[model samples]
Target: MSETIAPALLAPATSCGVFIIATPDRLAALQQLVAASGARLLGAVTPGNAAARLADQISLDLLLFDASSLAAGEAADVAIALAGSMAGRDCRIVTLLDVASIDAVAGPMFDAGATLLCNPSPTELAAALAGALAPGGTRLHDAAREREAERLRLLNEEVARLAEVLSQLAADPANGVRDRSSGYRGEPLAEPDPDPRAVRSTIRARRLRDQHFAPELFADPAWDMLLDLYAARLEGRRVSVSSLCIAAAVPPTTALRWIGTMHDAGLFGREPDPTDKRRAHITLTDRAAAAMRGYFRAAERAGLVPA
Candidate 1:
C-alpha cells in the first residue's frame, strides 16, 4: 500500500551478487525478485544457514533479510552477524518487513546497520536490488557511519570548549565581561525584526519549486524536516511525528528513520502529550534551533534571502 520504494540509480546494470535470508515460505518470491534483476542468486538460505555462509567468506553485494518471518531477536542477531562479517566491505543490507511491523522492526534493523523497506511491491524490490548492486552502492553504510562519527567527534570537542569557558566565567564574573546594557562599543545593537509570515512564505515557495521542478533532487529528508519544525516553532505550533512525516514528503518508513537519526544526533526532542500517551510531540532541540538560526543568518548575509 505504501508507494515509497527503494531509490534507484538512472542506469540499470547486472547485479554482482544477492543473498536472501528468509523462511521457506518467503524464499520463492524473494528468489524470483532477485533473479529478475539479473543478479546471481548465490543460493537462498535460512537464517542459520545464512550465518554459516557469511562466516565462510561468501561475498555479497546486497543482502536481503525477511524480517516478517524472523523471530523476536533473530533479525538483530543476523544483522549484527552480517555487519561483523562484512566489515570494511561495500555490502548493502536491506530488511523487508510488513507495514504493520515497521515500527517494531525498524530499531533493530537500523541498529544492525541495515536499511528498512516496508512491504515494497515487486517493482520496488527490483529497484532496490538494482541500486544495491550498482557500483559504489556498497559504500552507503560506510559513508553514513563515517559522517556520523565525525560529527560526534566535533560535537564533543565543542562541548568541552564551552564547558571550559563556562567554568572560567563562573570563577571570575568580570574577567571577560563587557557592559552592553545600552550599547556595544558605544553603538546600540539593533535587533532585526524578522517576519514569521515571510519565513513561512519563503519555505512554502521553496517547497513548491522543489515539488514542481525536481521533487527527488534532494534525498536527505533531515534538512527538510528541520526547516518545517523550525517554521512550526516560530508559529508557536507543535508537530506530531505523523505530521512531520508528511512534511518529509518521503515514505513514512524513510522519514521515521530520519527522525530517529536526528533525535540521536541531538537535533530533535520528543515530548509526550499529557492527554494521550499514544501520541508524542516533536520539537527542535536548542542546538538544532541555534544551527537553523545560524543557517538563516548566513543565507540572509549572502543575499540569497531577504533579511
Candidate 2:
C-alpha cells in the first residue's frame, strides 16, 4: 500500500447512517440487512406513509419499498413523491417491487429516478451500499476493507480492554486484560509487553465465549471501515465520533447514528469531544473491548484476521 493510499486501517474516520421503509414481510430482512451491512435503521415506515409521511424523520438510502397488489398509479405516485423528496437532499431512492409488480411500476419508477432493487438480501444491501457510497478513497469497503475493518474493530475492542487493565496495573500493579497477545504470534506488538505478570496470563488465554455484540454491533453500516479508522488513531487520542467516521469512510450524519447505537450498547460512553464543541468522542467502554473479542477469536479462527 502506498503511503498516499492510506489503507482502510489507516484511513480518516467519518460517520454515516441509512434508512429502510417496507412492509411486514420485508421488515425483519431489512433489519437484518442493516445489521450485516453496518447501516442504520432510521425507522420502518408503512407504504402509505412513505411519500407524504415520515419523509422528514429519515434520510433513506435504497428505500426497498413495496408496490405489490396496488394500483400502478398509486405505487408510482408514492415512488414519484418520495423520489422528489429524496432528490431535495440528493438522497437515493430505491424501489423494491415483487416480480409481479415490476411491470406496473418499473418504467415509471426508474424514470422518476428511483433505483430498483428486486428480492433484496444481505449481499444486495451491501452491494448497493458500497456502490452508493463508493467509499474507497479514504476507507474502502471492498472485501479486504471489510475484513480489515472487522479485524481492527475486534482488535480495538479487544486490545483496549486488555490494555486498560495493563494501564491500571502499570499505574497500580493489580489488574489486567488477561494478556493473550503473546500467544498470537508475529504480532506487531507483544515483545514490548512491559507488564510481565499480565503478559504471562495471556500465554494460556482461554477463548472468550458468548461473544455476541449488543445492538451497537451494527452501528454505521455505511462506514464499514470505522473500526480500522478508529483503532488506527487511538494512540493519538482522537476518538471523536466525527473523526472516527471520517476514518471509517462514512459521512458525518451516518457516523453519529452508529455512534448513538454504540453508546446505547455501552461500547461508547458519553464523553464530549474537547476540541469540537458541537461533536462528541467515543471511548471504548471496558466491556466494549470484550464485546469485540468474540469477533476477533472468530475472525482469527476463520483466518479472516492475523491469528
Candidate 3:
C-alpha cells in the first residue's frame, strides 16, 4: 500500500483537509472525489493503519473510509477505531460500504453519526462530499441534486412526525397505553398482547404489494422497522442493526438514517451484544413497544386490521 501527502496539506491555512482510508482499487476514485469537492486531499492510507495515522492528524476536516473491500473483522476494527478517535471532533465522516460490509461496519459508524453510503453512484459520492463541506457548496446546482435533497428533507420530516405521534401515544394514559405489566388504576386491562403471527402476516402482506405495484410508492421505512422490531420483541428474539436494516426493505443508508432518527426520538434503544463488542442489537424502547400494543389493540377494537 502507498501513502501520499499532498503539498497543500503542509499549508493547512488555505484549504479544507481530508484524510482517506480506502482499498487499493478504490483509492484513486476516492481521491478524485475529494479533489472534486474542492477539499485538499491531506493524505491517503490503508484501512489497517488508518486509526494510528489518523490520530496523528488532528487538523483534518473530513475522513472518508471505504470498507467495501475489507473482511468483516477488519472493517469492524477500523470502524471502532475511527469512532473512538473522532469523538467530539469537528471533523465529519463519510463511510462508503456495500451491502455485504454493512453488518460489520454500520453499527460503529451509526454510533459515530457518520454518513453511511451503500454502493452509491459517482454522483451520490460527489454530493456527499459537498454536503460534508457545506454552507459554501450547499446550493442545489442540478435537478438531480435538488430532487435528492428534497427526498431527504421529506424523509426527516416524516420521521419527526412519526416520532412525535409515538411519544404521545405511549405517554397519554387516556389512550389506554398504561403499564400492561401492572394494572392501571388497580384494574387490569383485558386486551391481550397482539399475536406475533398477526404482525408477521402484516409484514408479508406489505411485501406482497411489491409484486403487483411499485415498491417505491409505499416505501415507509419507519413503519416497516417498527413492525419488525415489535414482532421480534414478541417472539423473544434480538434484532441486530444489520438485520433491522434488511427488514426495512429500503436502501441500507435510508434504513440507517431512519434508525438513527427513531433512536434519537426515544423510540429505539441500542443493546450491545454480550458476546461481541463489535456488534450491537437494536430494540424498541418500552415506550415504543407500548405504543405498538396500543395501536394493535385500537385496531382490533375498531374492526380494522393492522397495517
Candidate 4:
C-alpha cells in the first residue's frame, strides 16, 4: 500500500488523537489513513510488542485494529485487553476485516467491545474515523442526521402520494370496480388503524415472507433491523442477536455488521445472557425507542394511516 494520504481524509482531527495497531502488512495503509484524517499516529502494534503497554501508556481517542492480519480470537483478545487497559477513558475501538472474514469476526469483535468496518473503501474509512471522533459516538454529524430525516420525509411523501392515488381510484368506480350483485358482498372494510402495533405486525409479516423468498435483496438491513427492535420493544418482547439477524433478512455476516453499526449509533443495547456467557440479547435504547414513537406519531398525523 502507498504511504500517501488521501486528500478527502486530510481534514484535521478533533482534539482527541487517533492510533492504530496493525500487522506489518496493514501498517502502511492504516498510517496513511490516520495521517489523512489529521490525527496523530502513536505507532503500530506488532506481535512481539505488548499491546497493553502501548494502550496503557498513550492517551488515544480511537484504536484501529487490522483483523485481516490477526485471527478472530487474537483480534478479540487484543481488543478486550485494550478496552480493559483504557477503561474509563473515551477511547473507541474500530476493527477492519476483509469481506470474507466479516461474518466470523464481527460478533467476536463486538462482544469484545469494538466497532468494525468490512473491506471499506477510502471514503468509508474517512467516514468511520469521523464517526468515531464525533461526540458520544452515536452519530457522524448533524449533516448525517439531516440526511436521514430527509430520507424519511421523502418516504412519507411517497406513501402519501400513493395513498392519494388509491383513494382517487376507489372514488372513481370506472376503474375495474366489481359489481356487488355479481358475488356475495362482504361487509364494508374498517378504517385503517394508525396504531403502530398494527403497522409493526404488517411489517413483521412482510419481513418473514421476504426471508422465505429473497433474504439478501434488502439494500438497507440496518434500518430494517432497528424497526424490528422497535416493534419487539412495543410488544414487550426480547430478541436475541441471532433472531435479529434472521429478522434482518440478510446473511448473518451482513446482519452482524448492521447490528454493530446500530449499537455504535446508540440505537441498540446488548444484554448478556446470565446463564450463557456466549449468548446476548439486543434491544433498542431509550433514545431510539423514543425516536421510533415520534416517527409513528408523525406518520399518523400526516394521515398516512388512520388515527
Q: Give me the candidate number with maximum lDDT.
A: 3
Residue-wise lDDT of candidate 2 within 91-177, one digit each (tens)?
555566644454444434443455555444435444555454444464344573456456447645665665564444344423334
Expressed as tens digits, the lDDT of each residue in 142-259 for candidate 1 is: 4544664575557545544544543444344434565646644553332232456756766676577676677766544676787788888878888876677778777766676677
Backbone clashes under 3 angstroms, per model:
1, 23, 0, 1
> Residue 244 CA error for candidate 3 (Å)?
1.6
The parts of candidate 2 lying over 4 Å away from their true place are 1-14, 58-62, 66-73, 120-122, 133-307
Which runs of model 4 end up more than 4 angstroms from their true locations?
A: 1-6, 13-16, 47-50, 98-115, 130-142, 145-223, 226-269, 273-307
Per-residue lDDT tens digits for candidate 4, residues 183-284, read 777654322324557557656666665667675554456567767887788677778766787777665545666686567666688876565443457888
Q: For model 4, what is the error of residue 128's alpha carbon versus the real structure, in angstroms, after optimal superposition?
A: 2.2
* lDDT (10s digit) by residue, model 3, range 155-202: 456545555654554455445666556544564333357999989988
**Which regions of candidate 1 are displaced past 4 Å?**
1-15, 111-113, 137-250, 256-286, 292-307
The best candidate in terms of TM-score: 3
> Which of the two candidates, 2 or 4, achieves a greater lDDT against the reference?
4
What lDDT score is found at residue 85 in candidate 1? 69
How far does residue 7 in candidate 4 sit from its true spot (Å)?
1.0
Lowest lDDT block of 10, candidate 2: 201-210
Query: Candidate 3 vs. truth: CA RMSD?
Result: 6.4
Give the runs in model 3 whose Cα sits over 4 Å from its true position.
1-14, 136-191
Full-model lDDT for every candidate: 0.64, 0.46, 0.78, 0.63
